[model samples]
Target chain A: MADITQLEAFVTQVRRDIVRQVHKVNSGHPGGSLGCAEFLVALYQHVLQRKEGFNMDGNQEDIFFLSNGHISPVFYSVLARSGYFPVEELNTFRLLNSRLQGHPTTHEGLPGIRIASGSLGQGISVAIGAAAAKKLNNDNHIVYALCGDGELQEGQNWEAIMYGSGNKVDNLIVAVDLNGQQIDGSTDTVLPLGDVKGKFEAFGWDVVTIEQGNDIQAILEGMESAKTKTGQGKPICVLLQTVMGNGVDFMMHTHAWHGKAPNDEQLASALAQNPETLGDY
Target chain B: MKTYIDTGKKDTRSGFGAGLTELGKTNENVVALCADLTGSLKMDAFKANHPERFFQVGIAEANMMGMAAGLTIGGKIPFTGTFANFSTGRVYDQIRQSIAYSGKNVKICASHAGVTLGEDGATHQILEDLGLMKMLPGMTVINTCDYNQTKAATIAIADYDGPVYLRFGRPKVANFTPENGSFTIGKAVELQEGTDVTIIATGHLVWEALEACKTLQEKGISAGVINIHTIKPLDAAAILKSVAITGCVVTAEEHNYLGGLGESVSRILAENHPVPQEFVATQDTFGESGTPDQLMEKYGLNAAAIVKAATKVVARK
Candidate 1:
């Protein structure tokens, strides 16, 4: 197990990176990035059993796919800090000729990204394929994917959800960032995703809910528990209940900041809350 | 004149199935996926032999496309089978973002293309698939002529390292190509040589163009015939060389005139050498339910149409 204090500091530093990267470009989806800070930090720091270097074909490693790729700020920061690439490369988050695209893509030869996923609802299906490949190779490592709750509105997600359980893709675990917020408005106002847990359960998934998604200990514990549910006949779904903007006080609990960057004063105030846990990029 | 004999008659989709079965036995990295059309797509032989690699996606084309793109991550060569309409138009965005833009090695093998998908009407018959696929960057578009060529192209695309769109049809046409021939990408095959006019054809129209050549011979018109299997990365050198010898050209295909082989040939001719050209294709109209023979005649995509276009273009020359 990893130290809880170190994990918490990693999450704080990730939050700072998310805000700073988006603020520098003055364009990006920061709300979901902030919300997914703890989950991503815990995933890279404590959860996944990774190999030494980055290669396109992850033969036996625990591979991850970011289906909702708009939140690349958090994904890039976590990957760099976890030693996938140089930490200072975070300065080229969405710049010209940078490997870091606005969405996560493998086109630029990025080390961590295995697929291009900005169009939404594609990650789960891709994860299922990778999981199937793992089963074919007899590789016991698990395949993980993260998606947004609002992205479920795409009909493709339901098709993948139906396929995951029907085909018995047991080596896969899908986690939904159930922030209840989208670009339009609250999920309820825009399109109510009524009973998301029930929906997954009805689709024959072994479902679990992480009630405190923003907490480092809760996410780590929940992910550890979810890992044990694999190798069974059914796939697993972790409905992580997170705030749209989790760490910062002003950006939380709303959909307005879903794709907006903070201004000068707002950036200073947001950075003050998290402090500088591990030197800024 | 160089004469060719028809070995047999077989549906192009069966050739795809035969090639897939060969791949299943040879390449362990090759995997196949279908959208609940295993029997229609003739993938039963492969599925029966290797059930572990065969995935039945069950009527969800979008999911199948995404999964195929995903399978490429672990260095698996994925081949997705379905009708041309669902393979290209329905799940285009999935193919564009996940497969084409990402530069994954995926072979989108499509069957039941053009008006020859008889009785299914315009919805099932996709005439615009070539244009849609060729427009995307880094996409290799191939429309094979016959059964033997289709099988060879299917097996050949596996070794090529990029996304490919292999289009074929349902009806059993002429199988004249060699049984064990080498299928090279972006190379045109010259069937016969003449000096009056050039007759370039693709897909079902290649056989029709050959028949037109015979009739034009009787009328004292020596016509050149070329088989263009690969539409994109077109053999412009072969086209320009043939047209330079033969002053005029007649392009034929079982597709719309706006974005089929005819338009591609015209573009090459206009840039390099402007020549009088006539199109033997459907004139911007949707096809209705009819027999394959009747639809081919009604759409003016037969040997008679090709012969007429060749004679008219030669007259202008």
Candidate 2:
């Protein structure tokens, strides 16, 4: 386990990266990005067993996919900070000709992205395919993916959820960032996702709930437990309960900042709450 | 004129099955995924022979497409199979985002294309598939002429590393191409030579084009036939060379003239060397239940239509 103080510092740095990257463009999903910062930070910095460099062929190593690709801010930040690319490149978050597209894609030859996402309900099936490939290649590594709770409304996710369990794809884990907020409104208002835990359990997944999805320690512990449940004849689902716009005081508890960037005044205030432990990009 | 004979008849879907069966023994990285139309798609042999490498996605084509895209990350060449409609229209966005945009090396093998799917009618027949597949930037779109050509093309796409849409039909068309012939991605086949008019065709219409050439020959009009298997990276050089000699052209296929091979050919001619071109295809109409022969005749997608188009186009020239 990573020291709580050091991990907490890394989480603070990731939050800073998310806000500044989105604030520079004035167009991005800071809510989910901020919400997913701790889970991604814990996964990349501590949990995943990946190789030194990135390659499309993920043989002999674990791989990750982001189903909710609108949260590219956090993903790109964690990837760059984790040594996939230079931290300075985070400045070109959604600029023209930058490797960072509005959604995560490999078309621009981005180093860490394996599949093009932002089209919801796709990443889980991609993860299952990678997991099946790993089994075929005799590689003993796991495949992980993250999806938003609102994304579950797409019928294709239900199709994939059924396949993952029916095929006995045991070397896989899919986590839902249950922030309960989407573009229109909260998930309940937009389209109620009732009994997600029950839905996944009925689909035959081994379920675990991280009640404190924004807390670094809780996320780390929940994910680690989820990992142990793998390779035992079923796919795992982690219901990570997070706040929409987690770190910023003004941004939290509302769905307004889901895809809206912060203004100059709001940026300074958001940064003040999470002081930069590491220098800014 | 070059004379041709039908050795026998075979459905193009069986050709795909045969080619997949061959890949099973040769390439270890090759994997197959079917969306519960295993019998209709003729994928029984590949599934029987290589059970471990085959994935039965069970009537879920969207999931099959996503899984195929993901399987490519671990160096697996995944071939996804289903009807033409389900393969192209129903799961288009999934293919666009996950496979086409990402540039995954997958083979979207589609069967039962066009009116020749016969008794199933419009819901199963997909006339706009070629247009949909070709519009994507990096996608290679292929519509095979016969069983032998479809088989050869299926085996060839595996060695080539990119996304490909190999479209074929259900009817037992002429088994005329060489059984062991080599298939090239963007090259066109010149079936016969002529100077009055050129007849270009794809899928089940190549045989009709050949027959049209014979009918035009009797009327003292020499008709040339170019079998265009790959429609996206079209054999533009061959089309240009043929049109320069023939001076007029007729494009035919088992698809809608609006977005099918005819439009693609028209674009080529209109840009470089515009000619008096004719389209021997369905005039923006859906197909209905009938036998393959009756449907082809009713839809005006056979030799008689091709000959009429050729004669008229030649007169305009």
Candidate 3:
């Protein structure tokens, strides 16, 4: 295992990247990005077995799709730091004529993204397709997907849930960023995702819930458990219960921060909580 | 006029089944998914023969579309089988983002298209499916006339690496085309050659156009019949050649006169070759619950309608 200190430093720098990118663009969903920074760091640094460079086709390597692509801040930050693209390009986050848009997409011929996924609840389906493709090609590589808990309210997600488990898509590992909050309010207030775990279980998926999705160790264990559960003739779903804004003090536990960016002072204060480790973009 | 004979009446869905099974035997990457409509979609053969590749996605068409788009990521050629309404309109967004926009190699095999879907009424009968699918960028839209053509299109779409919407009907109709005819996209098949007027048809209307061609010939009206199987990436060369000779056109389809094959042809003619054109299709009205024949006749999609359209176009010419 790598040093916890180094991992923490990486996660911290990822958050800094997210803040700097979103703050510079003055647009982007920062809440979930910040909240899921540690989880993303843990997955990229430890959980997933991806290649050093990002390839769109993902021929022989494991693939990951950000279904809730609005949380692109965290995704782009993680991807850039993990060596998908240049760290400097994160500055173009929502800029006109730049590959980096407000949401993650393959439209701009983005090096890492294989499919466009700004439309919520569609990523899991794409991930399942990728996993199925892996099985067909005899690639044996796992496919990972991350989606927001609130986005699960889309009927499309349930369709994916049913398709994945029904087809025995066990090569896929799907994690729901159950921050409990969305753009409007708490998930219960917007739409009660009643018994999400039970729902997935009933749909024939192997369900795993991470109580501390924001913590590196907890996220790592959750993912490890998910990996062990693969190839069991059932798809896997991990309910990651994390704070809406994970690391930043002012942004945490608030729905307002779900898609909102922090001001300069707020950005400075947030960056103070998470020290630069991997060097900020 | 071109002389055409019907071998027999067979549901186009059966042709899809036969083609899918044939694909299974030849290609390992060919996978099929049905939204709990395996029997209706005639996918039983594929499911039974290639159970490993066949996926039953339950009643969720949207999810099924998304999954099909996803399956293409790993280099699997996925064919999603469902009614036209569910395949295009119901899951357009899923198809838009994952399939068309992402440029995944997927075959959206839609059965029970147009008013010919019959008895299901307007809810299940999607007259706008052709338009909906054709409007998407990088989408190849095709409507096969008979079982032979449906089978050919199904097998052919598997080879074409892009998003394709292959539309066919549920009812049994004419099953005569070359059993092993080479299917080429954007190439119109001249069923009959004449100069008085050009009768262009797609889907079930191809049979009607053939029948109309015979009737028009008996009436001393030399009508040229062209089967435009591929609606998008339209065969401009064939259409212009036929229209150039006839100087008038009659477009036939079991779809809405608006945004149907007629409109597509009109748009092409308007831009490239100006010609007097008539449409044999459903006016802007919803289909009612009726037998397939009754619905086709009521919606002005029968051979008699095509004959009338040919007469009018010939007169104009």
Q: Pick the candidate with the highest TM-score.
A: 2
DockQ of prediction 3: 0.69
User: Candidate 3 at residue A172, lDDT?
Assistant: 91
Per-candidate interface DockQ score: 0.75, 0.91, 0.69
Task: Give candidate 3 misplaced runs (Cα > 4 Å).
Answer: A55-60, A272-275, B314-317
The residue-by-residue lDDT of candidate 2 on A51-84, one tens digit each, is: 9999898788889999999999999999998999
Chain B TM, per prediction: 0.99, 0.99, 0.98
Native-referenced TM-scores of chain A, all candidate models: 0.99, 0.98, 0.97
The per-residue C-alpha lDDT of model 2 at residue A221 equals 88
Residue by residue across B17-45, what tens digits does model 3's lDDT show?
88998999999989998988999998998
True contacts kept of 2: 0.86
Per-residue lDDT value at A255 in model 1: 96
C-alpha-based local distance difference test score of model 3: 0.87
Q: Model 1 chain B: which ten-residue window has the lowest total lDDT?
A: B66-75
Determine which window of 10 residues in candidate 2 chain A has minimal summed lDDT: A1-10
Q: lDDT per residue, candidate 1, B163-194, as tens digits?
A: 99999999999889889689999999999898
The C-alpha interface RMSD of every prediction is 0.9, 0.5, 1.4
